[model samples]
Target: MELLFLGTGAGMPTKERNVTSIALTMYEERGSFWMFDCGEGTQHQVLKSPLRLSKLEKLFVTHLHGDHIFGLPGLLSSRSNQGGTASLTLYGPPGIKEYIRTSMQLSQSRMNYELNIIEIQEGIVFEDEQVSVSARMLDHRIDSYGYRIEEKPKLGTLLTEKLNGLGIRPGPLFGMLKRGMDVTLEDGTRIIAADVVGPPVPGRTIVILGDTRPSEGSAALAKRADVLVHEATFAQELSDLAKEYYHSTTKEAAQTAVEAEVKALILTHISGRYAQDGAQLLEEEARSLFPNAYVAHDFWSYEIPVKSREEI
Candidate 1:
């Protein structure tokens, strides 16, 4: 799985960056993409990337701020025109469903595919055999939420040498063995998959948050995350301004990562006030404390390494 930033600017759009939107490329895992906060021009942002519009199956909106949701109507309209045939599911805090429905109705926007909207309260928002997502309210101006996504451990890999040594002769049995099934040899011998299979591969977790100040829930939601995408709307030098606006500073963003014990931290929702020339300073301030911290930009992508069961 991979993360692709569609827009990373905070507050408003600028010539250099658009508003807040992120796409989790999960086609390899589930044959679709999951979007986070469809900001203005998000569909336009997707057009600039290699993403297939038809593969957008899920959306998680953090809050109902204009910068976070202005693109929903346009994106829905475009999906209809672009022939999106798959049903879509959306999850967010309360009011998201009504907001989308009202926006589409007033704008006369039409959708060709089925849309499933979910207003999350707390606890597990989504769960399947392979993955589960939890939501918790964060300290934002509105009823905002942060999502913690955990991918379940994968089954053990098939040990070819063990199977070959037992003369198990691979065929459709390999599939069964990979699924942790036992097989019986033709010579009246029995081989169990657990006895020969490797260990379970550990899962990966990721946390993404919307606009908020430095809060304990933010750190809790991102605990031990492989990647934490957070908002750093201002430099550390502007801590006062950040607090005034109820946004985080570079130091606060990195500190959140450190406190959460995240493997990597990506700072996004940047304020356009920092000109292009000031980009390095913005990144340096965060990396100074958290060496693994990365400054996010529009279209930036990252792949979280997944180890085989044997390696894990």
Candidate 2:
């Protein structure tokens, strides 16, 4: 899986950055992508990336802030023009539905595909065989949320040599065995899947938080995450201002990552007060607390490496 940062600035668009929007691309795993927070001009940003609006399957809004959701109507309408006919689901806080509906109505835009808007609560919001997503309330000016995306554990690789020794050649039975199913051979020999299969491969966990102060909910949702994406809207010197605005500082974001034991931390939603050079300072401050912390910029992409048993 890969993360594509479309816009990383906080509150407003700057010459160096736009606003808050991220694309989590799972083309290899699910042949689709999911977006978080479509800020103004987000469609324009997506046009500049390798992502396809037609392949977008879901959009998760953190809150109803104008900077976080102003581009929703335009993006949704343009998706139809770009031949996005597949069903799309949007998850967000309560006022999201009204905002999208009113915007589309006022603009007289019609969608060709089915759009599902789900108002989320603090719990497991979506689950399938491959992945599960949960949401937790955050301490922000509004009812902001943080999302935890957990991939399901996969079955171990099939022991081809061991199976061959047992007279089980590669065939339909091999597929069954890999799926943890027992099979009976032509000679009436039964093969137990557990006896031949290796240990289960652990899945990856990612946590993305909205604009907020450092809270316990952020740490809970980010526990042991492979990647934690948190907001750092202020530097260490302006921590008091950050807290007053209900936003997090570089130090606070690093503290959250450390408390959650995350493998890596990517700080986003940077305040416009910090230009490119100032942004580097924020990263340096965060790295002082958590060595793996990084400051994300617009158009930057990061691939979350798969963890093996030995690495864990």
The best candidate by lDDT is 2
What Cα-based lDDT does every candidate model obtain? 0.89, 0.94
lDDT of 2 by residue, 70-134 (tens): 98999999999998999999999998999999999998999999999999999999999999999
User: What are the per-residue Cα lDDT tens digits for candidate 1 across 1-312?
Assistant: 999999999878999889999998888789888999999999999899999778888899999999999999899889877779899899988899899999999988888899999999879999999899998888878988889989999877788998888776678888888888887877868878898788889888989998899997798899889899999999998999999888999989999999888899998999998768666788899999899988888999998878555534
List candidate 1 segments past 4 Å from native: 308-312
Full-model lDDT, candidate 2: 0.94
lDDT (Cα, 0-100) at 233 in candidate 1: 93
**What's the lDDT for residue 294 in model 2?**
91
TM-score of each: 0.97, 0.98
The residue pairs found clashing in candidate 2 are none
